[model samples]
Target chain A: MPHRITSARKLMQGNEACVHGALYAGCRFFGGYPITPSTEIAEGMARLLPKCGGHFIQMEDEIASMASIIGASLTGTKSMTATSGPGFSLMQENIGYAYITEVPVVVVNVQRGGPSTGLPTKIAQADTMQARYGTHGDYQAITVAPASVRECFEQTVKAFNFAERFRTPVTMLTDEVLGHMREMITIPESGELEVVDREKPDVPHEWYHHFEITPTLVSPMASMGDGYRYHVTGLVHDQDGFPTANPNEIKAKMDKLRNKIVRFADEVTQLDVEMVDDAGIVVFAYGTTARAARQAVHMAREKRIRAGLIRPITIWPFPDDQLRELLAHVRRVLVVELNQGQLIHEIERVAPKTCKVAGLTRYDGEVLNPVEIFKRILEVK
Target chain B: MMADPIQSSNVTYDYLRVKKRFPNVWCAGCGIGTVMGSIIRAIDKMGYSKDEVALVSGIGCSSRLPVYCDFNTLHTTHGRAIAFATGVKLAKPSLKVIVVTGDGDGLAIGGNHFIHACRRNIDITTVLINNQIYGMTGGQCSPTTPHDSFAATAPYGNMEKGFDPTTLAKAAGASYVARGTVYHVQQLDKLIYGGLNKKGFAMVEAFSNCHTYYGRLNKEGDAVAMLKLMKEHAMPVKAAKVLPPEKLEGKFLTGVLWDVEMPEYCELYQNLIDSFQEKDKE
Candidate 1:
């Protein structure tokens, strides 16, 4: 039997795909404030979520909207919130709370050009580092970047799964380009999709500790009102979720929280390798800019240059080790992003010291073109 | 041979979750304890199972109400209790969701969420403990802090106007809105019960006192004396009709001000699912 192949299916915009992805992921609660670029997500959720037995709430502001979704998720509902730069900034404190408290939440940050409302409608990936370290603490965050409408749909679902499985906040790090762009997507029928639920504690309510780590380093969650009397706090705490001033307890809890994600880096991180098996030059890219890099890689190959593209789907817990291996053979690495050299720094740190590393940076609110990336690749070479 | 008028059940207050420890965190004669007591009594009267309720709160003195309750409780970040409570309610609509937050937590830093939650009309009861100052943060100005009130932040006076939580909720499309003060104990209980029973967003703004913070700074007298002052200044909604505006001015109105039903956000979503299922069947 031959596998059925489909061609360029009519696609939805990245933001629209996120809405569909959330629906498919069993997200029944959406609390968000309407902001540009991100508003489509909220609008789609409001219009479609209700039809699927999911609630859509337009909160007073980004702060409450972010908090409400976290609240909704505690009741064992799949929940999410969408925001742009300013809203994302307001949500950082609670985002940190979500991190420390180990609340599973999907936060969609549709990136806009910013440093304080730089351009609400324009596109930029300046938030790459922000997504990894925006919240004010040392806790880890899982961030996924989608380059196209289809990836948006696919990755948003993945984001929810990661958040639930890890019992931590997962950021769908999208920008205005992918969020607002419309494209055709062939969504899989129900039951064909894989959904992951958070691991509930096997221990009875009386013995259950809310923050106790299992062998897998992931804590078993017990919803409130189940007779579990454990405390959850933003302070560094022991396994019981109670505040502990003990340095050892703090170190143990913090290490487990951070290392769980890092140790399972293989399970969490993902990237696309194209023409990389015998390439001398590698272009590392993510999100919308990755689209252009793909084209640039092909163009570079057409010119008889051995060029390849490494497109990261999971931006955080970055594929540093993988990049190190790829850089072993590749003579030069060109990192292209719609930001002022954010991920380039990560690449610089990961690349072999001998490998020539450079960045193709942009923050002009326009998507980087393949021509620009090609020019930058030539300049670095 | 005198008969005891108060039975053990009446004297015991079975709904009180932490009764063995009678004296709570509230100061003597503080209205917060009274408000908490009324909430417990109302929950008891409503016959809600302790196991089926989740009390969530933010960082504030009044937000500590959830800590005293033995139900599934969460003392979360400042001004974000409504958000956390929203999560709990959405996750378990079968459970009654109650948010206990002070005026500062709910109306100032959290004002955006407060109004939006009402607009969405998720089925949750919010008990806004309006003590007129950020008591937990030591007498700072709050969104509900009255105009010309003095606090640590507002040394001379708070020239800014205050928020009327009930009015804000009503304007924001809350399905149920009510105002009660600690002085109106029975009436407060009734309002709380009504709000709890309402199908959509239910907000009960309880005029609590912050004698330790807002009181001393504003010369509102001691805790006991401030509570007495609250009692003196409270006027029932029905009685306010005959009283002159000047006499009734600044008096706390105590009663169920609004009660109406609209489709709750969750139920509406459920209907959408039903409709989608129908389409699939077709």
Candidate 2:
């Protein structure tokens, strides 16, 4: 007997792929506002979520959308939201709430030119820094960037898994270029990918604490009405989940929240590397800029110039270890990003002390082509 | 007997969190405690178990009530309690979701969410404490603050007219709308009970006070004097219906102002899902 293979190839846009990926990850609720470039993700969710027995809501604004997803996630439902710059700005406060409460939610920021609604329909990687430090406070953030339509789907599911595993909000950062581009992506069969759910409390109901800090720095989460009647507050609280002004308790809670991401940075960080062996110049890029970097590497190879590309899938954890090892073999490093030297700062900080680091940036709305990166590669020589 | 609140408690204190002190963060003479008492009584009378109830609140003095309650409480960001409750109710329609909010939190910064929640007619109860001023923020003028009233921000006097929450909620399409005060404990309890019984969005605006702030600034004396003033001023909606239009002028009406049955947002969504599944079968 021959096994049948279903046609997995479908022409899909990046934002649309993100919607399907969220569905595959068992997302049951989505609350978000419609913004340029990211609107397709919301529209796709509205059409598919209800059809798939999920709930899709277009909130009045981004703040409510962010709060609503957190609310839904608290009930042990996988939830997400999608938005661009302006809407993402409105969600900052609640994003902080989701962080402090340790709620598992995925927020997709399809990047557009910003600073004050700079360009609604244009692609730019200006929000790389914002994704890390947008909300006011000290906390670790998990942000993944996708460069292709296939990854728009793959990375969105990964974002949900990370959110549930760490019991924190995860961000998927893409740009208008990838969000709008239509390409063929293989849809994996059901059960082909791994799905992670938050750990439920195995303790007795009376002894359950919502913020119980375990040795792993990740605590088990129980939804409302799970026979574990507990309190979830944004205030600094003790292990019992009651607000306290004690400095020792506050430090322990804050330290655990921050260290959870640090201790597991290797587990959370992801990078795609190519042609690094015996390379003279290594290019580090992310999001749409990495697409151009891939092409530039191919062009450099044809000209007999040794060029390598290291694309970061997980941007928040910075992929410092991977770059430190790659920088050792290279004479110089060229950091390419859509913004003006944002991730370059991280590269320069951790790059081998013997190697010089330079940045090739494009803050304007136009997407960087392969020629721009190729030109930078030649200049670095 | 009154001095020993724990001994003389009429309702079950099982739902109340034991960790928080008996004396909450409310001001010395604030009326929020009375309102909170009324809400607890209503929940007690409704016969809801502690496990089946979920209380959510936004930032403000009134939002602090959730911390003192043990029923799956979620103290959220400022002005987002109702929105959060909407998500909870939608996710678990079996849970009785309630929001405790203040005038400044619910009507000012959170006005958009408040109106949308009412418009959607989601099955959740919101007890809005209209204190006429932002007591938590030390007396800024709020949406429900009376015109020409003195607040810390409105030193010269407020220039805007206050809103009647019952009318605002009704216009926003709440299935049940009511207005009561801390002065009318029995009536407020009954109104909240009516809201809980409804299957759609229900709002009970309990006109509360900032005796430490509003009373000091307006010369309304203490908490007792403020309650007395509200008692004398508040007219029941049923009573106002009988009086002539001119005679009812300058009177604030209380009691349940509106009640109607409508398809709830979550239930409608569930039915919609069923309908979609039904189509797939055909």
lDDT of 2 by residue, A1-381 (tens): 111124678899999899888988889899988899899999988887877888888888999999999989988889999999888889999998999889999999999997887999898999998899999999788999998999998898899999999999999999998999999999878788887889999989877788888988889999887878878889988876788889999999999899998889998889888998888998889888898889999999999999998888999978777788878878889988887778888888998888899989888899889998999899985
- Candidate 1 residue lDDT tens string, B73-160: 7778888888777767765678898888888889887787788789889899999988888876678999888899898888989989
Best by lDDT: 2
Instruction: Give fnat of each prediction, in order.
Output: 0.63, 0.73
Local distance difference test, each candidate: 0.83, 0.88
Clashing pairs in 2: none
Q: Model 2: per-residue lDDT, tens digit, B238-264?
A: 888889989877778999889999989
lDDT score, residue B35, model 1? 82
| TM-score of each candidate structure, all chains considered together | 0.89, 0.97
TM-score of chain B as predicted in candidate 2: 0.94
**DockQ of every candidate structure:** 0.48, 0.79
lDDT of 1 at A314: 96
Candidate 1 lDDT, A131-237, residue by residue in tens: 99898879687999988888888898999999998999999989998888888788866666788989887777667778877788898887666656555566677
Query: Global lDDT for candidate 1?
Result: 0.83
- Give Cα distance to truth, residue A6, candidate 2, Å: 8.1
